[model samples]
Target chain A: MPVAKILRLPLRLAVHACSGLVEPLRALARHRSLFLLLLRRDLADRTSGTVLGFSWLLVQPALQMLAFWFLLELVLQVRFPGRIGFLDYFLVGMLPWLLISEAVMRSTAVLNDLSSLYSRMAFPIVLLPLLPLVMAGAIFGMVYIVLVGLLAGPLAALYAPLIIAALLLWLLPLAYLLSVVGLFVRDFRQFLPFVLTMFMYLTPFLYMPQMLPEAMQPFMVLNPLADILAVVHHLILGLPVTAGNWIRPWLLWLVLLGPAWVIFYRAQPHMREAL
Target chain B: MSVIALRGVGKTYVHYEHVLDRLREVVTGRRCHREHVALHPLDLAVEAGEVVGVVGLNGAGKSTLLKLLANTLQPSMGRLEVRGRVSALLELGAGFHPEMSGRDNVYLSGAVMGLTREQVDALYDSIVDFAGIADFMGEPVKNYSSGMFVRLAFSVATCVTPDVLIVDEALSVGDGIFARKSFDRIMQFKQAGKTIFFCSHSLYQVEALCDRAVWIHEGRVREDGPASVVVAAYNGFLGTPGGAGAIVPADAGAGAAAVTHADPVAADGAVQPAPGAITARLLKVEVEVDGVVGRRLQLTTHRSNLAVRIRFVSDAASPVPTVAVALTGTDGRMITSAGSLNDQRQLLRDTNGVTEVTLSFPRLALLKGRYAVNIYLLCERGIHCYEEAAQIAEIEVSQEGLEQGVVSLPHEWAGSVES
Candidate 1:
């Protein structure tokens, strides 16, 4: 079969893409018990034999937040334009940032890591990529609860759903696309953590967007994470917000996700052989 | 109704010389990879409740066929309609988690096989019991033996009662006792009227368990028929000395239309018979029963007489030659051989340069299978062969009696049973 034949059937491709998107959701819903059990196992596997089992999830990110806080606030002497404290301002955006970062970075090797599932047993490949997301989500939810309790007022809780939606909208497509592409290019995994670190510095999560020179503000639009963090910062901290800031990230999201969806669906059939 | 129907089903894989070739093929609008056809287009329909065994040599596309049916690999071409759920035991411990306990693995594997948690829970105890490792269910499966692993894996796979069960050499593992138990479980499934497609190198198992058999040779179905007939033909093909290099005449056993071709001389020139010198050569060999001449000699009644006739021509100046014949199984193992010199029998020298000899068996006691005959003309001392024809003829023995092994030995029961 020619590649042109697959491209010609846009209707069929749309149907396949829709089904591909829904399959993981349906699998997770139908096998929620198994999903939860796997999630528990994943947590245990990651934390077992450590001195601090469950607390390690909080400790690692907390330490990283402290280190970044010291570097940005004390060393670099960066300041925000609002009345919100630096910890409060940073935690609000950092919570979702940590979630999306963990989901994408860990998911790059998710398929290769669970390759035994594909070769040894009859497993739904759609659910493989979702495992990391779900695992990260559980930890993220836990951390978010603690952060909201300690650092912010109850009003900040109202924006949790929107922040989560924004995070998933951005992370899911990238995770799916990268996981599929990662199977063919193993070096992508080796280069992933470096790239994610680079992405973090590029996004304005550590520093305020206003602190960036005016000339660099337009480039912030190019980083979807920057737009997402900006929305999260404004909604949770009551900072100033503009319609262009909130809406442009979503428009960029649409632009990024459309090709991811098509590429993921096209690559799915070939995944068995590639793996 | 057919539970599985495949029309012109085929699978082809594109082999790329380099990784960039694949990218180029996808990016550019040109084919840059070599196409390797794993399976040729063929039609097959398997009805519900039929146990069809696939017999083939390695790399003969048996696994590919099973994978296509199992829905693990997409067929490159053709239409395939598989009714009902398919559960394939393609390999043992395929979905097993090494760190998880066997019990947890069962639930996880069951869910992966499309069963809900509740369904797996309901069958959990039975699955553990069937695996016969209830004591170790709490231990991680990685600690289990290979047999135990296969047992747990097979138990979970079959516990769901899939509509179609495709097994590929999964049962060939483990101890003999466990193998028997697995076969019994499969037989129960067969009795329950589930369609089964089994592939194995053990032709005996295929013959014993399958209702029908499909012999795949070189990616094509060489023969498909009743299990006994197809297996017999395959056995005959394998028994030929040169493997597949020997061409089987189309009308091999179709009666008087005999086909003849010169046999290739032996590789050792010193051992090769003199070229163009027909001192003593066997012309035709046939099996006869009750004065009837044919290629196939059917043994309906036990202890029936069978006669093998050989026609030859020789010059008077040639040394008096001895005749020898051997019967070999389909696997090319020699069952028995007889020689005139070995039997201390004398041949009546004929001056006409033509002769016919017949070796008769008073009681033909072979079991059900195709057997091949090897004919040889030896010098007077029976030490050197003037000419020899290997697999000269094939005889098929069909018996209604259920017997195992290559031959049926005549015996009498004298002891009484205590029961």
Candidate 2:
């Protein structure tokens, strides 16, 4: 059977919720070695034994971004405002977008992915999705560290700490919300990639939000990725980010994430049975 | 004092289907519309530090009772209470994912089972050792051998130091080595004085492990007593009239087959077939060929992945539950009996429960043979719950050499005699 069927088995809301975990509460405190072992297991499981397994992680996005750039820059002759190489423009947005989207979207499937482990041990289901986010953010952190510490612009040097903090802040809820909902509906199995695609265009991955029509800019700014993208431009390019870009989008980020926090909170009670 | 107590405990679950049914029910305000009444307000009492083996045909409310004892299911109508920490391995690894490695399963499933991170950390080395998947821990279980998988799941289940441990028929699988290890671990739990409620069809395992036994047929318990007595009664029930001898109404299902009569007499008891019985039975179960009166048969209905089939005779109007077969030994200690009564059976439950014939033989794997068998039925009038023993009847075995082993098992033999 496909992986989808196995993830869908525990539909009993009564069992999927709180009471189901009475026997296995030790997953909360006693099992640190188990946690590390599980973390190592997750890494080994997804990345080993396949052709170009871990390497594919790097090759996949790098190829995707380069393809997009070559299509626009070489074939279509489209250019960033200042004749910036297509690579620079695409990398500036796609890199963070990849990190953010993968971090947020993939987080939802963590619990679903480890159904084998969670079902048997009575461990914490919350760790399923959260572990992936931590991994993604760590990967993102390394990337950001390289770009800012070694090769990024003078602006990257100025706002490095702030960018890291904001990214971390943005990531916490992103990882949490997707995970909780994943347990309930696993809607991400299909819609998550599409959301990432939609977010790609909305957040200036290919072009600045300002490049679009004025009417559309507000909608774009409503996205957290757009706010972060605009901030990235400001930090790395030394370009000015307008007050409307910052405030409105910040409010939108808060709004987008507010209910997600509540969802994460409400879901803990029912998580064990579902896991 | 009883650590576990129940009075009129019952459980009802709604059938679940696709998303559409769920949504429709949500909109129409029909909560769990299709109710599956599991435990029918049955009463129970178990003292602390006692090992109780629960015997039941599948869906006879065995899992329901375990889950309810763990508070995973609250009673719908009766008061129930337990004053201790419970560690249930019910459907061990109920949430394991093959994609994850054995190690992760240990942590994730361990946590799900109630081991705090620190507790898991402390027992990490021991858990890994117990799973015996030491090398495969870092590898995903998708690649694990079946034996290895069971080891990991079992270790994680028993890792937490629990006050009460509930084990299902987990060891029913696994290699002999792993089974022995698990058996030892369970024995250790016994020495430590943790209350254990073991559920399995293996009377040998139950006899070896439990001090007392409770047998359930249908959703109600039929017998509860010392291991020797209840197990003997259960075996007697399985042998002859217990199964395969059910009667069907002349107008039940379309194209109904004609009913057959039970045999006349056997070693332990006599078989008497009543006229106007609803159904027929054909069996070849191996009984105590010429063993002493007590411990006549140690029938362990081989737990197969195969489905089960069973037959029984019921009175027309209503059927009640009854029986207490006493197996008298030739020399000494009373070995066992196939009782129709056990303490676990809430005899007064199921006042409104179903009265259809139940067939429970695991996937028709029982070896065909000509063997002696016994029968007992608890018949009740229209509405009451307590039932009277129908008849302690006997029959001859006819199924012969269809398969090998005490109960037919799915195995292959590959050795050839030298020419």
Q: Please provide, for model 1 over B13-67, each residue's C-alpha lDDT reduced to its tens digit, 9 standing for 90 to 100.
A: 8788887887798799799989888899999999999999998767889999999
Q: Over 4 Å off in model 1, which ranges? A: A1-23, A48-51, A69-82, A256-258, B170-173, B241-419
Model 1 error, position B393 (Å)? 27
**B349, model 2: CA deviation in Å?**
50
Residue range B1-419, candidate 2, lDDT tens digits: 99888888887765556545656777888763466777777778888889999986667888878877765554567888887777876766565667776766777666555556676778889989877678878787878877677677778777765778887764333543454456557768778988888787656557766899988777777899999899888766654444332222222222211212334223332233223232212221122222312212223223322211112333333333432232211111122334434433423322223222222233333343222222333222111111112212121123434454334446566779454
Q: Estimate every model's Cα lDDT from 0 to 1.
A: 0.74, 0.57
Give lDDT tens digits, candidate 2, residues A1-275: 65766665444332333332322234324444555656666666667777887665556665775687678878898766664554565666666777777777667787667665544333445455556655666556556555554446655655655665576555665666777777777554677788777777667868756589977765764576777777777666655687765676456445445455556656654554555
Fnat of candidates, each listed: 0.40, 0.38
TM for candidate 1 is: 0.72
Name the 10 consecutive residues with the lowest summed lDDT in model 2 chain B: B381-390
Estimate the TM-score of every prediction.
0.72, 0.62
The CAPRI category of model 2 is incorrect
